[model samples]
Target: MNRTTRLQQITVTLLSAGLLTLSGWGAAASPVQAAAASVAAPACGTGDHGLLQDLQKAHSGADSIPLSFSDVEFLNTNIGRAAGNGFLIGTSDGGCHFQKIYEGQWSFQQIDFPDNVHGWALAAVKDGQAKYLLRTADGGSTWTRLSNQAVTFERVEFLDSSQGFGYNRASTYYTKDGGESWSLIKTPANTRGAAFTSRSNGWAVVIVPGSGYRVMKTTDGGAAWKQVLKSSTSDPIYGQISANDSQVYALLYGDSGMSQTSYSLYGSSNSGGSWTRVIAQETAGGGPAPGSGAAVAKKGPASGTPGNMVLIGKTTAFLAGYQPAAEEVGVGLTKNNGRTWSNQKAVPGFEGVISFTDHNRGWLAARDLNSSTLYVTKDAGATWTARFSFETAGR
Candidate 1:
């Protein structure tokens, strides 16, 4: 374990017990910095640590970050997960340019695409009733509006090459041909997330009016649905969804009070038939073994896919590998029923939002405050590889 984690444990121990050995918040840590243990270089492709060091020195303590389709998919897993081998790792050789800022349209928040080369980006207008969903192909060089009219879109989820799900005003929209076409489904409110074990068997978690959150299961690929679990307690947040072919985890967060909230994570073992509550506070390490009881250890093939990710709270962590203690910030880890997170590392440049494809496979798609380029580490946090140097970077 690194010194940061050790100090964090001491900190949490004191705080949770309602006792303080110190008198200031100077010891507080962000999860982004604490989760990562190292700062190694990126693997594969064409980037290096020396390059990153050169850029870091050039900027005098700034950060740079990047993202392709896969990176975006991982960060947006609340609505989706990896379909196969790697994230949609397709991009033009040069670079993709974000659309120009519209006066009150096209902000690039909601995104959906049927095929690899074409997609849509939705943004709520700054002071208008109409929102924009910018469509792109040829590697994001430019975008165009899909419609002149604006509707109540809150979140967007693409199911496949020709189908997807989107939400507005707590109602679900089903598309047989991407966002080009859409149909309304009977959702009670905005859906927290949607996932599928097989192409035909999928599940969703939605906010029910006056009753917190609930789960929806569909055996025929969401053609129809059934309610499995509904919380009598708190509602689900918008960004806590994860699943593989066999299992899924739907995470929800809402505090009843300042001091009475648990980590509040839930898992679905038998597809979506039942749901089990996991943690209420931040937990770390990998996720659980498939079909294994809490009393037994499971050895399924997918467990190695970084089982559960790790989490970083305001303070306290328990891992190691790279970087310095002071550069620490936020954290990103699994929140399942286990304690051995794999890619438990601090995402360079970005803070607070982190997601992994599996234990060893993770990525950060957020931008840095100092630069516009992207940083990546294939070996967790041991090192970093800088892409696009000699340009604007970020924090």
Candidate 2:
């Protein structure tokens, strides 16, 4: 009676009849948290995107930031890690790497917090002529450029250190003290995602002169901005805007069936007055590999489950959309919310590329088409355990 006990007895009788237990499989192993790797509760039971902390919202219901597993941490990336709901905040670089995820190993502590690791930004040079602005608080590693005074930056936001905001092509700039100096409040404004959850109010999901997708608010941080949800419909493109006022989460996408290409998502309990879709339209099998328009992983495994999308932290709401880069496919979790799941398995020799923290814990690295078996799971996603070894032929 194996195959994980006949898929847990057909998923406890189809989750007692409420239906949809393992749909097309979210991950697999089954029971006893799949028997080890540290899962106290989710074995398809569940996992990664970090922060699951034994998850308990059982079907997306009431999760507006109560996450504080010691304020959560994990960061040991040397190859860019963040495509969905990716904003670890607090900056990194000059010494500021705290990405802690246990069980499979991925703990980058590197601390020296001294705020504003040389803040800078002034954009617009993708050929629109000239104009640049990009300063990293350590996360982007290294980048500096203080001026060009908003030529075509599209968008840049900061609400700490001194204060910040930048939007080129349409125009808007305001620095309070940290960016050295800057001023200007308007020009064209066609932004798609901006955040400053604090320092006044801050929020942006722009494109307001007749385009669509608008929800611009500012208490003082950006100095002034107030359009609050105004999208008549210009094809949908509301990138992201994490929240704090009770709860808010927004990451939108559009233009996906051809080269004009564009997609990146999430939509929270929503904010202001309208807009409520909540992660959908994830068409995997490959999307970001033709000129680098950037957008893939919308339900990998050949477009199933409506092309799934998963994001677990930075204002956890379980929003999802596109995530199939096909290293054979990976993403599984079940801390009891979706009832049962396990065995969408792959880690025999390893080729999954997973990562996690705050719920049982998880991590897996090595992405060179194969030959990277590093594993660890603490049961929130139920089970796994492999430990050491590395090489994409080297490293």
Candidate 3:
């Protein structure tokens, strides 16, 4: 049998058994429909402090801060917005060129839209100085600063115009009046990430201190939570979760044994009720090859960091992470619901955020320490064309 067939067979067998152990070989806004299949499914991820530092450096020596996009959202084949490092830019003719919509000192770390007409942005000043929330109603063509509160959240997601969640590593807050004000929501301590399908359903990534990480679910908004998935003390879970309606995705990491660290992908079709091992234990040294059931890992890959995952629908998802096999950042695509995955184009970065409007077209914002590059793919994830590097956008 071919490697893909064999790996699919192994996945089915392991999934039927319950949890796929660390052995060998490794959101919200439902109310708003996607604008087009040729665009992305809104924005659904965040950057880390390292990214913020990169933004700070890029902001310091230039007359205009470059388009170091922390997050990107494409509403259609020809309309999109990219935000980061004191600026928000939009394009009316695909991504060929962009015009600035908003610029300031606070870097925009995340942006979310319930629909093409309603959106939100989360920003924080360099050096941990302050935080601000902004809103846009004309498809990001213009933005209005909503509030300049003491909000420490690094990410934001809106289920609709007036309901959304803003969370960080410490706590989560909910806003019902279009970012006007927020109320502290009691979540598990150290809630690192959160995503919601509606005003009433949500999931969170919580750190378990002495143990590991947890994937928790809540039916009544964020008032209560139940443990749906947990990691072992040795193989801790990463702090990023993405959910849309009843489908969810979470990450678990293997022990970083000095040389390399591995990761596994878990998927749930019924919210966070149960999970199946989509990708099995994949080590840095001796793991199976890409289409042979294991996702690749880099040597000494950052501990507690998992690859970025963006779900396109119920059956299609994209995985972006380090691919030591090729010594470049790689993209993996699964059309048969992770029964199999094909490693797609390799981009020039160690980390990336993927956005897909559907199975055919997508965009990737790939970043290294010195620059962030944008790429567009027309044939799903098979091939990519460099559109522009954010490091040189305004130069």
Winning candidate number (TM-score): 3
In model 2, what is the error at residue 102, expressed in angstroms? 23
lDDT of 3: 0.60
- The digit string of per-residue lDDT tens for model 1 on 321-374 reads 121222222233333433422233344342222333333333334334443333
Give lDDT for model 1: 0.38
Query: Each model's C-alpha lDDT?
Result: 0.38, 0.36, 0.60
Error of 2 at 99 (Å): 15
What's the TM-score of every candidate structure? 0.52, 0.24, 0.70
Ranking by lDDT: 3, 1, 2
lDDT by residue for model 2 over 298-385, one digit each (tens)? 3322122212222344233222112223233244433322223222343332123344433345444323333333444555334456
* lDDT, candidate 2, at 251: 46
The better-scoring model by lDDT among 2 and 3 is: 3
By TM-score rank, best first, the candidates go 3, 1, 2
| Candidate 1: stretches off by over 4 Å | 1-106, 110-115, 123-130, 188-201, 206-212, 220-224, 230-240, 256-263, 273-278, 282-343, 347-359, 367-373, 380-395
